[model samples]
Target: MDINYLLIHHDELLTYLREHDYAETYVNRYKTTIKQITDNASNHNWTTYEDVYQWYVDQSYSPTYLHEVRAIIGKLEQFHLHGNFPDNKKSYSSFWKIKSAYTKLSSEYKQLYEDFETQTCKGLKSSTVASYRTKISSFLYELQCKGATSLSDVTEKDVLTCFFADGVRKRSGSLCANIIRFFKILSESGNEEATRILAYIPNLRIARKNIDYLTDGEAAKIRQVLEDSNYSLSCKDRAVGRLLLHTGLRGIDIACMQLEFIDWNNDRIRIVQQKTSQPLEIPLLPVVGNAIYDYCINERPMSASPYLFLDSRAPHNNLTTDGIGYSVKKIMSAANIRQEKGRRKGTHIFRHHLAIKLLSNGVPQPVITRTMGHTAPESLSSYLHADMKHLRECALSVEDFPMAKEVFQSCLK
Candidate 1:
């Protein structure tokens, strides 16, 4: 029960004690405690009974005194009930969320990000870092969706939903494979509970699929419109789009970028990609560098922090993956691109386009894997590796035979 009820009850009980010849000093102590509780009770706040009782118990109240105090607290509870206060008014969800938010971050995320930056990214070639990044990012993206900024409340469902299957019925068996690796890392970092919950997750391996690449003309069309889009889009937004398209950098890598990391002198740039903790240095082409320079000089606001990207609003924190997607969609709509990939064209498709461009340019499979950060050198070979019109040409080859070849040569002519 609330403390105000107890305070009012104490007053009447004190008067009865005075009638029984109790000394003024004894009655005054109870009066002071009651007054303090009453002031705190105006907002219905109560120190938990266990906390209060533990303190009172240490003061060594005799058996009779304990019984009397219990009776008085009971009277207070009854008074609270009669006065219209109810116990279940607050939502536990909000309380738990607040508690989790205030809780400290786990050592695991810090270690993984650090390790990725120092060991994985630095020692590895430019491309292998990208694979490490994808593995980590897809996992973190799941955490962000669940509103789990802290480690304590993270459970198996949060892990599975974030890293598991893409919700298609066809790949039902492959959902649990990567989560095993992720949970092992967490458990090794001393999160036993997260580990325990993770054990029940199943084991399944799924084959990877090919990627669809956009043609140069098609890419140019999208680029022109993305720049001209009417969302009053910031130079930073357009630049981010261009960077993704040109370099195939992941969203989190972009998010964690800093000004000092740019190596303008040598035309190479370094990034400690957030997911893999790798320090990847890409040879920044003039186009990509100019786009980034424009954003840094013209768009980015001055701040105490060094993150290359910041929110447009005050108290700006880091932008989440969804925020990045929302911007991409806004620009894509203005570009008049179809809005059909799960209700949106993904920013990650830029990576696919990059892969295709490398293939079409006759860039080797190992080179694509290295530049894109694939652990398995052959991983990216499954990409369309050929443009759409070329694929059509190849498919019609068996059907139209000599005529199709002449048609293809005539087109090149």
Candidate 2:
């Protein structure tokens, strides 16, 4: 803790701090605290948290400053012990812990759940896997509460009750689908009870609701907002907004974009769509291209991270999907674009807007399908509901159905 020793070792400490992307203010504070400790500590060789804390207390430092100094001492001690700073930021959610129902399950059911989880992890995104696990856990917990300790003991009535409990009938479609998948997994594991329960559960047919898309005026307003020099929006915001509006890239795609993905020479951007894992090549329109260029050149932080978009703050981590969605919503609000009730108001609205634009321009369904990365041709059918102009074109004349008049007269008589 000698001042001379810290001065000599300043380069090493600075390097460690910088490597962790510690903010400038934090780094300066640490340096100041280390200098004070070096100058004042009776012994210049404290190697443990207790020794350091005692030294600070002996100095009669205030409680807050004592806490701060202790934190620095802890970091230094960790470095001496491990040869590297411990990642204090390392954390994860407890939601992913094994469900309580697992302990009550029969050995066979326990193994079945484990296998199902493993398979889901392999085929689905982490978020989707977590959702499936939650739903399955809830169902299992419900069954256990109903006095069914094993999968074999679960009756069709129990399954129905669990699916319909607590006003679940209104939201039963997705729950029904999840239950169906659970039963399928169990049936695959050779559980005859699961197959029997599956046979008795009727499919809940859910209607597809029309998605909200920006009208031409709203789209124009958004573009104008992005291009406005006096607007308070940051360069990153403008870049993300233009990319979503022009290319219809999903939020995850924009968040995960890399510098290497841009083919500047060809004026195209290539991305592996995160949701579908499909490779997409979108033309780099000049306006959108300029916005990205302005952001990268002007506002993007200087970091070695490969991602094109990053959090502007220190640590400079890649942007998340939620972050991008929030940016889009902010821009929408600034542009005075009101979100309708029950309509999704996120970056995805831009995608829907792009699809509607393509459809309005008379782009063929096959082309739209490819552009939107839809696996099925029929997936574009919902957009038809919004294309009233095209529907009018397809309207048949009443004169063309002369037999309809005679049928009406006969019915009246």
Candidate 3:
């Protein structure tokens, strides 16, 4: 459809959105985006939606804003061609196209995945189910490539080759775990073939990588920058930074955090974690509490989103994990952290710093685990590698194998 046509019927589109239960705020935001894109199209003498879309992509909007623009523009094109666009929430499963391997699979192999998904995923969260579906589809595809036609046709060598294939070892633990779960479910349903295949899945040793975290000096710089009032940070930015620094909340958890999660009267913040679906309650440190209040009272947009943090513009939807990561980068830039090339600068670094700080202060691993809302106690072991204070205590004396004084002098030089 042409830009002129969209511009002419933009009002009709907005009305249609409202009729489809889109929030009024979202409708209004769509109207604004439509006008903006159309105006740009007119100035550039661009007639088609594709022309406007290409132009929009070249602009310097933030990642979050760009996503909103892309979604609105795509919806407009869909509405102009058809009478309506697909409801995103209802189209979740179709969003991830099943791999070609599954497409080529004989009916028997395909049934294995379908049965596992339909029967085994009954009580699992949608995200977990989606993950399992992807893993199983990929594994089954590998089995097909290895010349297996059916479950009964598979051998231990086929299973081992699939498990140890290139780029699979890093996640061998999770991939194997999910695959095993699928087989166990099938076995319980009396698939004897599945029980035999289960015996072929090998246990994998997960290799832990060194974690990068903010040093005390770098963390102090972040604190100073946030408090300086010289960086012109939005209250929401400050609030998110403080939450990550003080509360050690995951970016996804922070993104999904709701207004009601806070207990102002008791100075505690409660949440059901997104990763593990477990409940966690943490103290609302005064720094975090004040920033949140400032954002909500003074800076937050006028919207009815139950989420605590939101997009600044109309519709004001909950902030995404990407949005939270962007905020962390912004705060780190203001503090002059991680500007060096190849340095890691994700929000999880703050999480790691918090855990290591807790460990350095002599907090028990169980206490730290609960505070971090880790799904398993072993999850905290990675941070132990970053806890330099206690690690030093475990160091052995070098007196027994001391080098010559001349060698030490040469090393020092």
Candidate number with greatest lDDT: 3
Query: Evaluated with TM-score, which candidate comes out highest?
Result: 3
Ranking by TM-score: 3, 2, 1
lDDT of 3 by residue, 73-111 (tens): 666666776656535322222212344456777788888
**On a 0 to 100 scale, what is the lDDT of residue 289 in model 3?**
97
lDDT tens string, model 2, 1-413? 23355557766877777787778788887778667766656545664446666777887889998766666766665554454553443222222236455566656666767887875568567777777767777777777788887777878788777757675663357867886888788788787888887886769876566666678898899989998987789899999999999988888899999999999999999988787677888899999899999999999999899999988666778898877987887897788776656656788778888888898898988888888877678877877788867888989997876786679899899
Model 2 off-target regions past 4 Å?
1-104, 115-122, 166-171, 185-190, 207-210, 339-344, 394-413
- Each candidate's root-mean-square deviation in Å? 18.2, 8.8, 6.5
lDDT-wise, the better of 1 and 2 is 2
lDDT values of the candidates? 0.61, 0.77, 0.81
Error of 2 at 157 (Å): 1.8
**TM-score per candidate, in order?**
0.50, 0.71, 0.75
Off by over 4 Å in 1: 1-171, 178-218, 226-231, 340-343, 382-413
Q: After superposition, how far is residue 188 of candidate 3 from its true place, in Å?
A: 6.5
After TM-score superposition, what is the CA distance of residue 190 in candidate 3 from its true location, in Å? 5.7
**Mind giving the per-residue lDDT tens digits that candidate 1 earns over 89-128?**
1212211222221123345554554453564255665555
Whole-model lDDT, model 2: 0.77
